[model samples]
Target: MSVTEYRQASAFGKRREPHTVIIARGDDIRHFTIRPWLAAFVGSVLAAMAIGYLLATSYLVLRDDLLGATAARQARMQQAYEDRISMLRAQVDRITSRQILDQQLVESKVSELLARQSQLTQRHGRIGPILDRVKGEAGGLPESAPLPASKPELRAANQPVIYADSSAASFWSKRPAPSGPETAADRADRLFVAINQSLRAIESEQMDGIGTLTENAFKTADEIASALEAAGLPVDIDTDDEAVGGPLLPIDAGMIFEARVRELDEALEKLETLKAIAKEMPIHNPAPGKPVTSSFGVRRDPIIKRPAMHAGIDFRAPTGTEIKSAGAGKVIKAGWNGGYGRMVEIDHGNGLTTRYAHMSRIRVSQGDTVDTGDVVGEAGSTGRSTGPHLHYEVRRNGTAIDPLRFLKAGKAIGKLL
Candidate 1:
């Protein structure tokens, strides 16, 4: 067919035209066509569209799965946080309870200390005055005065709260697992440290107070001993020397201090004994009122014209005046003796002895125990005397000393005399 007639017929029949072209490159010529090219381009575009659609669908599905996983992780984190909060609240409650118990224990200790202080105050009447003197002295103390006690050392908080990551990525770290705030052993150790510190502080304060008291007591004893020595009583305050060449007679300040300390210890023991006895002893007087006329030691003897040694003092009273035991003792002698008519000698402990001479009648017999102020005899001048009087004498180890010393030391001379 002719080209014009074929093209017209193909156009009229609605069929596409097929064309071929020849291209020359260098020495070679290549033939190219259009109908097969269109077919190949269309097939490639469809394949590309299908591949892109598949990729888009896979991406959407994967994104949806990731969102759901993220939501689940958030829920788990919330739950874990709630659990940690609950655990922290429990730990706080435990800590609070322990703090309350510690406070109660501290209050109990404070109450005990206060009670002890009160008891000590009552036992030592001079303590108040001494404390006042000390305070006055302290008021003028230098600013650089030594501090004997200081604050205690406190330990740092070794344990701290730690939060755990719930994510699986970090679950297997080699570090140790988190523990609670504080364990029972930790609290016990802290409490023990606190108690030890408190005890040390108390000990320091007590030692300081005792040192001050001992110093003052020694000073007073020294003054008293000096006065007594000046009074020509042959008074020497000395401790038993153990060393061979130790001062045969120590009258120095050191010896005086040692003696004073020993006496103070003895006095404390005696005070305790006296407190016990005061609880049981009768408060009322059981003896008749016998008026005392003469005092102890170095008095004029009526029978002897010359100056003579009068061992005991005389109490001028009626013949029926009752004689009493001054303190608790056992009766040793209640019969007659030379120069003393109808005398009763009572032996109290601690080398103390009392004798009641010139009695009209004897109420207690020998080997009888009598308490303080117990009626032992009736007052009368039964011995070689001029008038009706009772002779009273106090002796230490069978040697006559001043009876007034005990009466004065007892601070109850008015009641007895």
Candidate 2:
């Protein structure tokens, strides 16, 4: 083939190239080389590398952002959990504080109760023996007789010798053991149980003491009555019958003693309740104002010319003098009576009754309950009285008794009249 025909075939097979290439500004030289395949391969490799780099960078940034967000969310959740935990801890602390305060208060109250119980026990400790002697005398028992002057040795030895150590020995023997180490809640429970047990023990002991005292009192009363009967005095013993105008009989010693014991028990129960309420109250005398204006016994009648049996003791006072109840009881009658003007009759259970006569004003009505030292009336001269005075009578089953004996016994018992 000719060169022209060859050139034409090559031109049709080759790709287009740049027209010129400048080497210098003034005098330029131009050269051209045909390498289309190599250029295209290089371009494709560079483009693919750029695209891969960009995609890898984007993926890395997105992964970092996602990890940071996940970490933040986890941190927030942890903080929330910690906050809840803290709140719960605070609540627990508050509850614990309150529980501690309550426990302290209870302990204080219990201590006060214990102290009051101790005081009461001490105050009433000596009353039992005195009452026993009296009861023995009242029963007319052969063994329970007063010693004659000839038997000085027996009388001297028979007298009771009071000692201070007796109560200590009893208390040490009866008190409960201290609680052992345990959780606070368990300890508190044990403490309360022990307190209750102690209270019950004290109550039981007090009741027993009261019963003994009552028995003794009855015996002494019986002995006194028997002595009076033996002395040629006209005395009678009655029970379960209302008293009339006639010479009333002496009370049944046993019944009167039992009644007194019951009354003491009831009074003790009330006192315990009061002590519980007044744990921190100040101590004071129960009877604030009291004075004995008269004594109990037979005397010449001021108005009557004939010898008469005196049923009660009279206390002279100015008109409108305040009259207080000597003990806890229920009012059975409050009004003007046949010979007792503005009288108030109180029934202390167990066949014991008290009458306040010649009162100017009655503060209590029938069926009204009154406590010891309660204002029941105003003293005045009424109903067959010579002057302004209070006629106080204590009766057992409607039988009159000597007021001096009871007053003296109450004083010996450490009672506040």
Candidate 3:
């Protein structure tokens, strides 16, 4: 046990010897012997183990760095994805807000349009009667449907319907034409513009029609007034009497139709006044289809053999021919008169009077109201040397004027009546 022994061995054609290792500590020595082959084997084993350990250490260190880098990269990727999502969300929110604002604006526009529709409807009602009354005289306006001509609802369950042009001052034009592709809102807006333009055109037409009617009415009234003026009668119509006293209610600036309506009303009132006066005068023929046999003038008296003033015209007919009043009036005198058989007299106010002489039978009594064409008497030959005929006189204040003048004037304005 104290001596080391080694057996000889052959390796790679060389004789191998045992290797020795000695250790000394504090003068106590120890020695160990190893065979050469064994030593080489052990050295090889140790080198392999060192190499394996170094490789394992390097792999662990590299793996930690790789894991840390990978984690950082993943975190960066997650943060970037979230940032993209946030940006998209913000854009969506902005778009939603804008859409909401647009919806509200559209709703406001719809409300304003509804109000205008109501206004236009009221206007139609106001002028309906006036339009009817002037149909015959002033070429009638075209009949149209009531205003606000569309449905009131501007939205459906899923989408909004943006139509109905409003009366707001700003809505006078069709604005902000749609671009890109046509949407429901765009289509509805187009419809609104078309409707608005069409309705406004109708309103414009109405205004024009009323203006024309007023002009024609004024013209007719002027004609009547001129005719009456030539007959020693003056028409007195106060058309522009500004005796208005009321609260200062301001109207919308867009209400130009009101002025037009007022003008038409004044014109109509004036025409009505003149027409009433014209009707009251001796305008209609007392005897329809009756021809005048004798004209009123200084002529040879058939029975007196001298030239005398013939103050009335004579209409020869059968003795029992019906006679009528020349105008609307109150009967002043009726029945027998000196040399004029059964006579009838009418006082058409304003100092105008008419007489029907040589009547066999008088139908109207004193104080009886008689309209134009009313049967007042029957024609007869009881006047001074007159055959079966009617003697008609138009006198003013008891003096005879040319009955032809009144007749001509009546014929001139007959169509207007």
lDDT of 2 by residue, 1-417 (tens): 578867886879973553443465566666555466877888999999999999999999899899999999999999999999999999999999988988897788678766755644543443444434334333332343332111111112233322234564466468676577566665565455445445444444544555654444444344444433442233334423466467756776345535655654443333333322221111111223545555566667778765667787777678888887766778999999978888998876656677889998889899998877688989888788878888888787888876655554334323211
Q: How displaced is residue 200 in candidate 1, in Å? A: 24
Query: What is each predicted model's overall lDDT from 0 to 1?
Result: 0.59, 0.60, 0.75
Backbone clash tally (model 3): 1
RMSD of each: 16.9, 24.2, 6.8
What is the per-residue lDDT of model 1 for residues 167-190, given as tens digits with 9 covering 90 to 100? Answer: 422343453544878766556544
- For model 1 the TM-score comes to 0.35
Model 1 misplaced regions, further than 4 Å: 1-272, 276-291, 412-417
Query: Model 3, which residues run further than 4 Å from truth?
Result: 1-51, 135-179, 239-255
Q: What is the C-alpha lDDT profile of model 3 across 226-285, one tens digit per residue? A: 887876665888756598788977776356677777777777777778777888888667
In candidate 1, where is summed lDDT lowest over 10 consecutive residues? Answer: 160-169
When 1 and 3 are scored with TM-score, the better candidate is 3
Cα error, residue 129 of model 3, in Å, equals: 3.8
Order of the predicted models by lDDT, top scorer first:
3, 2, 1
